[model samples]
Target: MSTVQLYAWGPALGAPSIDPKCVIIEAYLRLLNIEYTVVQTNDPQASPTGELPLIKDGNVWVAGVDRILTHFSMRNQDANASLTPEQRAVYLAYNAMIQENLYDCMLYTWYADMTNFVKSIRPTYAKLLSFPGRYLVPVQLKNSAKARLAKYNVEITSDDTTLPQNEKEEMKELQRTGWHHMYKLARETYASLDAQLGSQKYMFGDSPTTLDCIVFGYLALHLYPDLPHGRLRHILTHEYPRLAEFCERFNAAYFSREHDVSTPAEDVPSLWKVLVNNPRGFFSNVKDDIVSYMGTDAPKEKSTAQIDFERKRIWSIAGGVTCLLAYIIWNGIISVEFDGEQGDFESWDEYDQEEVDEEL
Candidate 1:
């Protein structure tokens, strides 16, 4: 009998949950083949600690992904129990990278890019809410995300006008520089992951592990999402093909709903290659980053709505001018004395004039 119920944010954009913590914990449960029911909710107030992705077992509740995983591990024994101490250390390090660094990058990618937030993230509320609830909830979530990013020294602006006159340009420059650096850092993390994943069937090899679940949570979102800002996605799919392959391999094994598991040739970088390429790229990126810090990337183009508004404004002005000129001519507002009857000018449209004349 299943007595455990997992509470998490509902699916959005075809994902099981937009919350990585929730997704990872769910993946862990699946990996363990545990029987549990999911209870989706939008309200954080429903949770024991006012945070999401909690698990309820009988009368006891466990809050948070890490705590929940720990609880399951203590009860059922960790999937990573086979990992040696040194391998476990490496796994923990990568898990931390996903949780602390990659998680923030995901948030910034979703919230900082307004196009994505409006197009994909915002509409998610309508899936589970209505009216003002749909409107207010997304705003609250976006604001909360911004605050979290700010805590990590990531600057976010809801509007350009919110900054001071002189500081607007400066802040924009800073944002561009910061995002480029942030993306670069994310790439470095992926490269490390590519190296770590190697030819192993799992993170440590042979069987699935806790680290594999953690990595899957982050990697799946990075690869699967049709994000507005896809720098990280491109890097994952192209720059680190091995990581991409690893994701595919893992997906085929556990997530694909098939029971067959096959070991494929993992593209692990050689020791010399890692030693050479990593440090060489580090210093090169450092030099490039210094130059990047001194400058900014080009500003993004106006969104579709903004561009449409500008186009409409231009057409409106042109139409208004044409209407004014026609009004003046029709009313004889700009007339001069002529050798012809003034009313004759109105008969230029012969078809309409003939019809009116016949009616008269």
Candidate 2:
């Protein structure tokens, strides 16, 4: 059988991938002792679902961590095979809690929190992209994060002086209320995880399972990155030291090798190589990225103001490009040059005189 190919976001800050989902998938593969070559890419479009941590084995392609696990299950490689039905039920409950509550907290800290977004998140993603993507992707990710949190009534807001005094007060109150709720959720979730872990090495007995991988994935991101506003990290480290210790041990066991197993250097594609091999695909991905960045992936019922704003933004970009091209042409930076020899000509008076003398 051919070695499986794992496509994920590039690693950063001691994590296999900046994305927690990617980290979970990588850890699961390592835990299973699967022979897979990691293919690092910044483009989420590589996956059919337009997400990361995809796996390609022979003719089969799996886009998500859950679906990949299901794919593995068909081959009798289930990670939670040893778990009792009761334990599996527990795992599902905790998993949903983590995904619903803790994941939102992570998103808020990394993207919605302006301090962390500007200081850590944006810079991290910026390094992974090329050209305009460096400027665009971070903002898109931030907007997506905010949109995801909107349903939870969580938001990050800055004081808008343009608004009326009462409106400004309302916004400020909403910001405080939202973050307070988020912090509370994070604290409660950590406490529950810590209580469940107790002194056990793994979540369930000696062997690590899918739940362990998921827990570690979230914990590692919180513990590893040195974010400016690090509220989630603060809660985990100070309030839930057991969870913190679990993350440390987990990291040492799976990720502390001299040669990193998750991202093999040779298997990773270079930007130039991707462009050369599939230029059309590469630009198509870029266009998709730009459209996504513009928040086209948000809910279909956009406000009229938002629609107008997007239209103006597109027109502005087009106008800017047009102006740039016109400037280049007008300044002779891009001009037509003739190679034909030049013919010398006399003034009209001299030509007339010469003609008269010839006639005489």
Residues 1-360, candidate 1: write the lDDT tens digits. Answer: 545677777656545567777778877888888867777765554553546677776666777878898888888657877889998888888888878778777777776755556567666665675443453446556656677778656665542112223545544644663666567668878878878778887777778888888887887777777765566678888898777777777766666652222221132222222223333332343344334322355554555664553344345444544664566566653444556655333332222211110000
Q: What is the lDDT of every predicted structure here?
A: 0.62, 0.69
RMSD of 2: 16.8
Model 1 root mean square deviation, Cα atoms: 23.6
The residue pairs that clash in candidate 2, if any, are none
Candidate with maximal lDDT: 2
* Candidate 1 segments exceeding 4 Å error: 151-153, 159-177, 257-360
lDDT of 2: 0.69
TM-score of 1: 0.64
